[model samples]
Target: MMDEAVLEALDAYVECLFAPQDEALEFTLSASRRAGLPDIQVSPAEGRLLQLLALMVGAGRILEIGTLGGYSAIHLARALPDVGTMVSLEASAHHAEVARANIEHAGLSEKVEVRTGDARKLLARMIQDGEEPFDVVFIDADKRGYPEYLELSLTLSHPGTLILADNTFRGGAVVQPADETSRVLHEFNLSLARDPRLDSILIPVVRERVDGLSIARVKNI
Candidate 1:
């Protein structure tokens, strides 16, 4: 309901107070830019929210469906315990390589691995291999694949596992759902709400525009 500029300023204010970037995060952003990656990484406030959520869930194993220059990965990995680990899937080999370098620069290589491939294939393979369930799964990949990703992620999660999806609002388009992507996202939100295995809510996140992040906790296997 607020002006866009005001919303951005509020985000900045929150970031300045609670998510101030240190050297590693700054380096990650700069290196990501140098590599010509899209500037679609989570905002600092949202990154901090991810970190806090990981900490709240005491996540030991984290799975990320998208790794864009490792910006959000750094935040999530920072929440891990010394022995905790994360596996992030990136569709672009170049993005994965950039993410690896950024993560290494952040001294988080030991805690994080960036795998390059189609996220759906990678997730399906992990499921077929009977991989250990993850404590948290962050979904931030292609919009159209969101529903499939959610289903696959559930296969990789256990009771109490936390699931997060970004850009659910599609800049407020989900309300009217004018396009295919928005309609899909709208239905995704509806499914999240009705799915018996999970309890979920969509929280608005502001940047250049209003978007949303859907947070769900698996209540039953």
Candidate 2:
């Protein structure tokens, strides 16, 4: 278990680095509080990274696998061009509804759409319908299904596409693999490391209990 002092120290550092919030960001933060959702929201560093990635990749088309009250999507879409598009999938209608309300309040409804359903099903359907290959894809969904989500998402990416997976650390149990979530994450991490298609890196984020940011670039299709 992580020591309380370490957790407190990390929290202090994160608070110190907390970025400035605009109307949209404030609303997303409020929605998260109102929903009492877990701390799955993006960190300040990751938020900055998302914007950088979007602009760098010219992310005209984006796909997000976990809406989580639209925190990450808002960060990403804020970086997107006026003509850019972002489609987010949330299994919980409650969360999706909150996200839509916040997106609309932020005047981004036209550029971002929050769909409610199983992410796997929704992604498969989008593929069948000929949606253009996503330029940026973020996966922060159910822990046990991380591998499946990663595999499915890879099929829709090109060399320029960026795939970011959250919570790959699973509170440091990933290195041990004693629990199911850790075991799955461990397998996923190993697979990601070996995959020839992607050049990747893992960043430790969060409190004394760390999480990960796995940034992978797909090779040419």
Candidate 3:
């Protein structure tokens, strides 16, 4: 968490590894700009990794807990085949509309659906409706709600599903545990690692943040 300089260099390395955006990604970025949102973006490197994860997992269905201006959504959706569907939950109607335009520009409206509502409520609804389980679940939204999202997403995921949760590092706060956000995140990481059902690792990705991805198989006895 104290390795800010190294993190920056690693981010640079990630960008260097991925080539410049294709036409689709270019259009997606353009749409996000047009929508007057600037924070909704993933680094070029992370986007490529998300695409690879989808392909590697043969993901036909993905569940994204956040749809921030549709940046990460586009990254994850790029992994989907023609019939794949990425269902994202967002809390802001304004942002959801902005994400929709960006999704349209990215030509992923057919493959991704952005639903604006409280994620907790939405997940409960999804459970009740008996929706199909997802192959991958990406959690990058509200910091405090991560535990709840993780718990619910696990219910909707199969044994081999991949779960990626963002912002675990919380900018050096996780080590100090002085602030409220840091405390929760630190606990989340500790619990995830200790949980008998999970095999997890945290990778430093951005300033004050770690992409905490865990791979696990549901142990059905």
Q: Count clashing pairs, candidate 1.
A: 0
Residue range 71-177, candidate 2, lDDT tens digits: 88888888788999999999998888888888888888999999999988988888788778899998888988888888888877777799988888887889888
lDDT of 3 by residue, 23-92 (tens): 7777767766776765646667777777787789899999998887887888889889888999999998
Question: Which pairs clash (backbone N, Cα, C closer than 3 Å) in model 1?
Answer: none
| Candidate 1 CA-lDDT value | 0.96
Kindly indicate the candidate among 2 and 3 with the higher lDDT.
2
- On TM-score, the stronger of 1 and 3 is 1
The residue ranges of model 2 lying beyond 4 angstroms of the native Cα positions read: 1-18
Query: Using TM-score as the measure, what is the rank order of every candidate, best first?
Result: 1, 2, 3
Clashing pairs in 3: 171-208
**Whose lDDT is higher: candidate 1's or candidate 3's?**
1
Q: Quick one: best lDDT, which candidate?
A: 1
Model 1 lDDT tens row, 1-221? 77989998989999999999999999999999999999999999999999999999999999999999999999999999999999999999999999999999999999998999999899999989999999999999999999999999999999999999999999999999889999999999999999999999999998878889999999997
Give Cα distance to truth, residue 167, candidate 1, Å.
0.5
